[model samples]
Target chain A: MFDQSNHLPALPGVGYKPQHYSDLLADPAPVGWLEIHAENYMGAGGRPIAQLKYLAERFPISVHGVGLSIGGECDLDPDHLARLEHLCDWLNPASFSEHLAWSTHESAFLNDLLPLPYTEATLNRVCAHIDQLQDVIGRRMLLENPSSYLAFDESTYEEPAFLAEVSKRTGCGLLLDVNNIFVSATNLNYDPRAYVDAFPLDKVGEIHLGGHDEDEDDHGAPLLIDSHGREVADPVWTLLDYTLARSGPLPTLIEWDTDVPEWPLLAAEARRAQTALAQLDSKVTA
Target chain B: MSQSAFNAALLNPTANRPNGLSDAGGRPAGKRFDVYRNNVTVSLREALETGFPATARLLGEQNFNTIATGYLRANPPSSPLMMLYGGGFPRYISAIPALAKLAYLRDVARLEYAMRQSYHAEDAPALDPARLASLPPEALNNARLTFAAATQLVLTPWPIHAIRAKALGESGENPPAHAQPTLVTRPEFDPILTPLPADQGDLCGALMAGKTLAEASTLHPAADLGQLLGTLLASQALTDIHVEERT
Candidate 1:
């Protein structure tokens, strides 16, 4: 495994937005770091890559990939893997991460993260893909747990157990999205705390916190959509506090991709996560 | 079900649920699967809308949604990059029989595609205007200018730039009756589209085909070469100028 000694700082960050590029360059503020979708910067060259070059000089950037489809049934796309390798080679980000969900199958790229059955077959497939990814990027990648509206009957293993097994086999780190735990637990009608307790916190290298919209499943159960369109909800914040209390501190990100708010608002959200991290530090030093 | 089969089911709403697919509670996952399906279609549709905003506006919300759905079902994204999505959209728009009345729609979509392409094109420093002016009079004939990667000349049979401006609320006047050839260039960050006269368009087309200034001028002898050069310089479209090597 590639050495991760210089991973992201255990502070609060936000997904980088183009509109806030000038503001960030002018005043980076107290923000700990910035994250970006890898695919967005995959173009040949332009303002997006140029802005990233500028920010990479100032902040520890995390390249969060949304398209790897690590959990796909088919072998990983060599072309996509090459592009990712090229990007990682150029950016040399502090951290690289992709979701545990699949977005591509049969060469058709589905835009959203889709869930998979957590079976032994899948565990093996995902581990192979993660191995390939780590080998190509020449660095360790954090596999983020996905928030889902449904679960499959073929899933022989629980989500947390499956993730633990994958980490054990691949030596990959985890990106524990507290909001995803809350959203998935709520949608699947389980206790969020239990899910968090069952997670392998020591294997976690980063954390994600995003806003979700509330709706109802067909059975009238509360369904939380992982829609990063607004501020982090109070429960998700509380969940973050819960997970941090166990994991100490991790590089947490405030992801607001859709209906993106002003830079100040997003910075404020990052500040809120920082407040929680500060509380953890206070408790630890106490 | 197999992973590919499951994905196929998710993409095609009309397809039957994959065998043995059930929710966490061991119940039928029909309603639950619908959520994933909705997420996929809705997100792709939103991406198409973002890529072709003017086309969406011209067709209106409901009509555009219908068209986007049909297009998506027919031509799902082959790449994960949203920027690379909707490449087949212009042709798809042109092939629609219902949109036959809007003859300029496809060209407008093509213009939008060009703007997107230019926005993401490779960055290069604009050549100084003096480089061209200081060229020895004899060398001027063989001087072949290299345009920036973001420079694109879009020739259309309709007033697409005007129509786009009106749709985007950038202009108050209605689109004119004449066909308009437009030049797209990204001097800084944002891509700008400028209307070009037919003669200038012909000259630009010729120049883009690797024709030297003298040879390109032959295509439009009456065109104001100075004005055309001025426009290109003003837009920072010319990246490098060099004398063509004698074979």
Candidate 2:
């Protein structure tokens, strides 16, 4: 019931951070939208709310949540949902999204986006949680793929297939994290391009670009860690370009959470995405 | 795996400490699990470094990281999105026996945490100076003043305001060697730290306890009640006011 073709802008965007507020507000970039971690603005009143409110007025906003724990066995958290609902009511963002992994279980929250076994039982539980979330927030949510460090033995389906199945079951969209695909594919020794091909492109509402770090397993197999602290690597850029060419234009975000550089550095990253999308679109027309 | 077992595997990895997992070739996967657990612990400890940089700096990074890891192992995050996490770290720091020598560390952590809490608290307009000043001298103290949602008072024995600034690379000698109560509030989208006069803190505390402004002023009659109200109003700390019926 919640289908909106214009939910996201065609231009590139960056995750909003207050340190860059002055830069973003003083000289509004050509960036399309500003995405914020939903929980950051859950407080009743404060600088986060004020600056976010100011930004939302100038650019489209997206509420990307990190703690919903959709894959957990427990029922959806009501208080967290209420806080999300309040944020949605105030921000009126363009699109909303959360991860496909669980970060909280029982009562302890590990504070890391951990992997979940891809199985029918888990799928059903996640879909039900999404339904509850949609009902509470009164809007559809886009579930993003997670960057996994380890694959569980109990998993039954591939990542893209699982995401497509979840979208079909829950009537929700997908926030395809291309960086996650790169990281997971490298860590698990799968082809990133093939994973993208298998993804439900039409259901994709957004895309994420970030950096990954290299590590090795006990046997010395390469492990790609989704650190999101550095610049986007050459191969990930190639993957993003390929995906954009196939899927057409979608709202993309450059997320650099750690070692956050100066505003101009991030703005340059967003500009790179803009150029990539533009080149892909031109190639498609040619 | 049952739902509970799967959850145990993911969330409570430290519960049974190390549940052995055997692969197809009979190799133990517990070592990999241990690595993942340690990474989780370190990641959270680093988050505290960002959340409470001043506290971490005051205790030095090496000592802070070691103590933070222990605190995290005992009290892991209650939420995945760390923006709202770390509320208990300040109190947890106080309970650690080894760091007890730095008696001021806990209060510094509390002051820093309160700064963050105030930074994300809420935005509310302060009462206009014109309206506040128009109140009768007698009614001024009797009027109940509401604080902005972002205002926070951290009554600490340490000069936290100075210590926090120094940690931020600001140039300043620590405040006179005396315990100072600090006021933290995001009056205009930026957190501000100010040292409060001893009597003024008691008055602010009285107001925080829902005391009528008149009652608060009565605690410190020498506090230039008008100017105090004016300064708080200008700081966006005074949000609302109502005359409390004398009881």
Candidate 3:
């Protein structure tokens, strides 16, 4: 099932920030790649574009989108799809992706990636949305797994099976965010490892490892919130190790959105992921 | 469902309470809708906090959160995602009847919002300083210079620049002596809010208004004309230059 056989690179990469542009450019560290939110650079001209240009010249770029509302019942957002096309034209990122959730209904942008039931109606809508995105952008996208809080009674399909179906239908790749698996598994009361094992590994083009927060559900049961804020937790690291062992080293990203740590701290986290991959490599070769 | 009715249902789910479109499954639909609404409101509020941490700090987190929620409900996002959430926030605050007593609030909001705008503003190369140096004094005066896309000269009746600086941690700096002109430029990736002297401010306004250098200088003779032009050029604030032949 694996066509791409080369081992992925093992250099550290942090979320590219405009505030640290000068610092990043000044010190030419051996950073591998930089990831940016596609929605932030949707506008025609701006500092976001400027800084991204400067960094893209030297580093591999990834355009991670937080919009597009792929799972929504409504048609694809033409305006967003156009902006995404423009971004792809301007910045030829190594990869482009969005979450497997809905964010908008009608015209009002809800601003959160809300979950959708895995039914035939949703599957058709999501496939149509993905087709529209590909038709506009002229490139395949990686759909990331979402961290969902609530489960719908109408969802007949299991999470992994639904994700596999989306990939099979749309020809889009998967962005496996292990932290989301842990969070959603805990919230929905499922086995995280089962999810990691069931994932269509051949379809996974990238990996996301982030930190989650501990919270209490309505029943006062412990839940994990995929906050993307603090350092990656030990359980998440273990899941990542499991994924690497299965996927055999992918382009893993460390995402820290809220309360972004200092550059060095983020750099260190990226290094930790690199170390995990290296450890896996040694075991596989031995 | 009809387009308008579907839109109404999505935007205001309560509109369909009579037909049971509100609740999904057995649970109250309002609870689910409330969760979605709360997420939208909180996300936009977080964008505001991220964009204008100083404003959030100055207004206090609770107050900012309260204002942000109201703004979200009043003007739900038109875009599928954020990145332009608070475009109307400044104007909203200016007319929010309750905030009328705080006159400077609008200016602060405007200043911070503009900074965010400029921060995300497009990247452009600054004008070459040597080009300015090569132009003859007469040609330099008559040359029509265009500022960079990220430079915005905002003239307000409030000491907005000083207020922003203080909010951003320049606590000991002296406040502006009076209402002044503020220049928001992104020399680098982040927007830098700098207070412009009266003469230089006039020159910037003239340049922004598509006036020739000579015309701008005529409006403010005391302006250091050389350094003022250089300040913009060095920072890439000036992008293109054209000198018209005398008619």
Candidate 4:
């Protein structure tokens, strides 16, 4: 087996933003760690890289990559892997993760995290990709479950089962995104709680929660778009509570990527996540 | 269906859904598949609309969206780095029949892209202007200077700096119907632009191309090389200075 774990404290973290850099430095509480998209810092040199260097010294950084196309059928992009290696070499972040989704086809990279079918073929493909990523990064990398808008007929395993098999095969940790779980459950007609019950909680190294938008399919069924443009929905928070109670506590994160609000508001969300972990802590102690 | 087919459909909204896709009911994923399609276009369009703000402003938001959709479908990103997604957009739109009349618009887009490149360029310290002053005249004449990675020279036949300034809501003198030369430099982190007097660009361009000071000075006699060198040094654009044997 491999080291499929991370060192992030089991506390709430917020995604880093340039606007909030000063605030984070001024009041460094509640936010126990920070996560950044690996591609944004792939540039040779800039303020983005310089700031990450500074922040890494102060807080634990989890390099969450969004563009690796880990589930694509093609071989992993060697140049992209080298860039990821270069970033990890210098930053040496506390944790790193990527979504179990494909974003590229041939030469064109679709900028969205497109869903993948969990068949034996894809299972093998994803495991190989993670093995390559972990080997290059020289550490265990967590794989996040993507929020899907539709299911595939070819899929041989349910989402949780597929995630488990990948973790088992690749020795990669799971970044259980409760919001994605909730969204996928509602869209795919499954009980979110049942889905969580089936999840392998022991392998979870971190958790993610983000805002989503509600829409409808052509059939008028509820469809949720994982638009991290606003506050997390109430039901997702409840689902997070359910998850934390079972998994104990983990390095939970609040991801607000679009139309970001003020620092205080985002920090408040982190405080709420902290309360969730704290509640679980009290139960264990009592 | 193949990932290529799915991606093709994602980029083209009118394309039919790939096989094997379905909603929870196991039926045809008509609108469900549309979600992925919508995400692909909307995200790429937003990246362009935000990236070339001046170009977006020249063409109003509504028009920009329409052009962005066209450009994205035609020149979908080859790489996953969205920061580098629009590298070819300036040329892509310059050939558009609708935008053919805005000849300077192409240069404006080029300037915007240069600014972005300079923003992410490697950081290097600037050589002090006094270093050039301390060099003896012969040594100075033979000196070949290196520029900061953030330095860029955009030479155009239109008042690009003025056009960009006005488009960005900055009050500036009405752009003349003549050529303009611009210098781009990032002293700290943010990239800024300086308008150079016409023809002085040749001197700076030559020096930037690694020409010796005497050789660059010979390229443009009317232009004040001393003043231009002082400005480049003041902008902290020069990184290294090597005085080679006089040639």
Model 4 chain B poorest ten-residue lDDT run: B171-180
Encode model 3's per-residue lDDT on A137-231: one tens digit a residue.
Answer: 88888999998655665677887898899999999999899889988887677888999889899899888888988865444666566778899
Q: In model 3 chain A, where is the ten-residue run with the lowest total lDDT?
A: A1-10
Any runs in candidate 3 off by more than 4 Å, and if so which? A1-14, A18-32, A43-47, B1-38, B80-83, B125-143, B171-177, B188-207, B211-236, B243-247
Residue-by-residue lDDT tens digits, candidate 3, B51-78: 6666676678788888877777667788
Task: Point to the candidate with the largest lDDT.
Answer: 4
lDDT of 2 by residue, A136-250 (tens): 9899899999886566666788888999999998899999889988887876667899999999999999999998888766666666778788888889999998899889999
Interface RMSD per candidate: 1.5, 3.4, 4.7, 0.9
DockQ of 1: 0.69
Best by DockQ: 4
Kindly report which residue stretches of model 2 are placed more than 4 angstroms away from their true locations once superposed: A1-5, A25-30, B1-39, B167-171, B213-231, B245-247
How would you order the candidates by lDDT, starting with the best?
4, 1, 2, 3
Docking model 1 quality class: medium
lDDT of 1 by residue, B1-247 (tens): 6777877787687998776755557666667677778888898999989988988898999999999988887788998888989989989988989989998988888989889999999999999998888988779888888999999988887999899988878898898888788999999988999998877888888888899899989878987788989999999999999896668
Model 2, residue A105: C-alpha shift (Å): 1.2
TM-score for each of the candidates: 0.95, 0.89, 0.82, 0.97
Q: Whole-model lDDT, candidate 3?
A: 0.75
TM-score of chain A of 2: 0.96
Winner by DockQ between candidate 4 and candidate 3: 4
